[model samples]
Target: MNPARFLLPLSLLAAVACSSDASKKDPVAEARFENEKRIGDENITEKQERDATFVVDVASDGQLEVELGRLAQQQSTTPAVKDFGQRMATQHAEISQALGVLAEQKGIVLPAGLGAEQQKTRQELAALTGAAFDKKYLELMVDDHANDVDAFDDMSEDAYDGDIRGFAAKYLPRLKEHLELAKQVQDQVEAAK
Candidate 1:
C-alpha cells in the first residue's frame, strides 16, 4: 500500500524488460536466437550444430567420391588409374556406409546426393575420357583426399562429440592411405604423359 515501495518494484520490472529488449537487439544474441528458432530446438548448442554439420558434409563428400570413382573406373584408360578408381569406389563405399550409420544414430540428415559444386565436378569429369579423364580424375582424387585427410584429422582432434571424434580417428588412417595412393597413381599418370 506504500507508494515508494510500489515504485521500487515497478522500476525493477522495467529495468529487466529493458535488458531483455537490449539482448534482442544484440547481433550475436539475435543470430543465436535465429539459429535456435530455425532449428526448432533451443537445447541444440553451437557445438552440437557444428558436429551435425560435419556429419552432413562428410556424408556429401563421401557420396561425391563414390560417384567420381565410378566415373574414373569407366573412363580411365590407364590400368593403374582404373585400379585406383576401383579402390576408391570400394573403400569409399564402405566408409560411406559406416558414416551413414553414424549419421542415423546422431539424427543428422545427410544430403541425398552431390551438392552443386560436386555435381559440377562430376559433370566436368564426365565430359572427358581416355588419358584426359585419367589425368583429371587422378588430380581430383589427390586434391580431394588431401583435403579429406586434413578435415578428418582436425575433426578427430577437435570434435565436440566423443563418438564423432572417434569416428574421425577411426577413418583418418584410411584417408591418409588413400591420399598417398592417389599421389602415387597421379605420379604414374603424369609420368606417362
Candidate 2:
C-alpha cells in the first residue's frame, strides 16, 4: 500500500474532473454568442443593426425578469412580493413572446436565455430566501424597471424602425408602472425589517 501512488492518482483524477466540468458547453450561451456575432457580421445598415441589437438585449432582459419573478414567487414569504413576482413572470413572458415575433419578422436571431450578467443575478438571488430574498428581489425589480423605462423611452422616441418605436412606446407605460410598484414594495419590505 504505497500512499504516494494512491494520492497522485486521486489528485490527477480530481484535476481532470474539474477541467471537464469547466469546459462543458452551455448550449444556450453558445447559441446566444453565435447569434450576436452573426448580427454583427450581417450586411445591414447601421440603424438596422442597432435595432437588432436592441431586440437581442431586450429579449435577454425579458427572459431574466421572467425567471427572477418565478424565483421570487417560490422563495418569498410575503404576499405582496409574491404577487409582484407573479406579475413580473406573466408580463415579462408576454413581452418576450412579442419580442420574439418582432425579431423573427426583422430577420434577427435573439438569444434563447439570459445573458452572463443576468445569469449571475439570477444565481445570486436564487441563493437567498425569506426577507433577504424579498428585499433583494424588490431592489432588483426597482433598478431594472427604472433602467428599462429609460431605454424604452429612448427607443420609443429614436428608433429607426417604426415598428420598434411603436413597440417601445407600447411597453413604456407598463414599465413605468412596474417601477413605481417596485419602489412601493421595496419600501414595505424595508420598513418591516
Candidate 3:
C-alpha cells in the first residue's frame, strides 16, 4: 500500500538486472572478437605485425648515409680520410643489408633510405672538408657509436625476441671496435692540426 517504497525497490531491481545483463555481447565487442579470431586463425603474431627495428637500424642507416655523403662532397681530403670514408661506407652497407634480412624475416617493412638521424648526420658531414670534415666525421662517429653501444646493450639485456637479442649481442663487439677506431681517428685528426 506504500507506493514510494514499492517503486524504489522495483527501480533498484531494474538497475541490478541491467548491470548483470551488461556483459551480453554488444555489436562492437562481437565484431572485435570476430576480428581477433580471424587474425589468430591466420597465424599473425605480434612480432610479425610489429615493426620492432630499434637503435641499431637507426645507427646503421645514419652511418651509411653520412659516409656516402662524405664521399660525395668532393672535399680536398687526403687518402687516409678517403680510406676511412670508404671503410665506413662498406661496413654500413653490410649492416644495412643485415638489417634488411632481419626485417624480411620478421615480415616488417623498413624505409629503403636512411633514417632521420642518419640523414641529419650526413647533412652535417656534408658541410665540411679537409681537417674540418675529418674532425666532424670522427666526432660524429664517436658520439653516434656511444649512443648505439648503449642502445644495443639495453636491447641485448631486454629484447623479447631471441633473434633481436642475438643480433644485438653479435653486433656489440663490432660496434665497440668501431668506437675505438673512431677515437683513434679523432686523435689523429686533432693531432694533425
lDDT, candidate 3, equals: 0.69
Query: Which tens-of-lDDT digit does each residue in 1-193 have in candidate 1?
Result: 7899999989999999999987758788889989879776634577788888889888888888889889988898899988888888889889999999998998889899899999999999999999989888988888888899988999999888999999999999999999999999988888888
How much does candidate 2 score in TM-score?
0.76
Name the top TM-score candidate: 1
lDDT of 2 at 133: 93
Q: Cα deviation of 121 in candidate 1 (Å)? A: 0.8
What TM-score, over all chains together, does every model reach? 0.77, 0.76, 0.66
- Candidate 2: misplaced stretches above 4 Å? 1-44
Writing each residue's lDDT as its tens digit, candidate 3 over 59-154 gives 455556456535634662755566666666677677767767876786656666666776776677777778777777677678878977887787
- Candidate 3 clashes between residue pairs 3 or more apart in a chain or in different chains: 62-118
For candidate 1, give the lDDT of residue 139: 84
Error of 1 at 92 (Å): 0.7
The lDDT for every candidate, in the order shown, is 0.89, 0.90, 0.69
Provide the lDDT at 164 for model 3.
Answer: 73
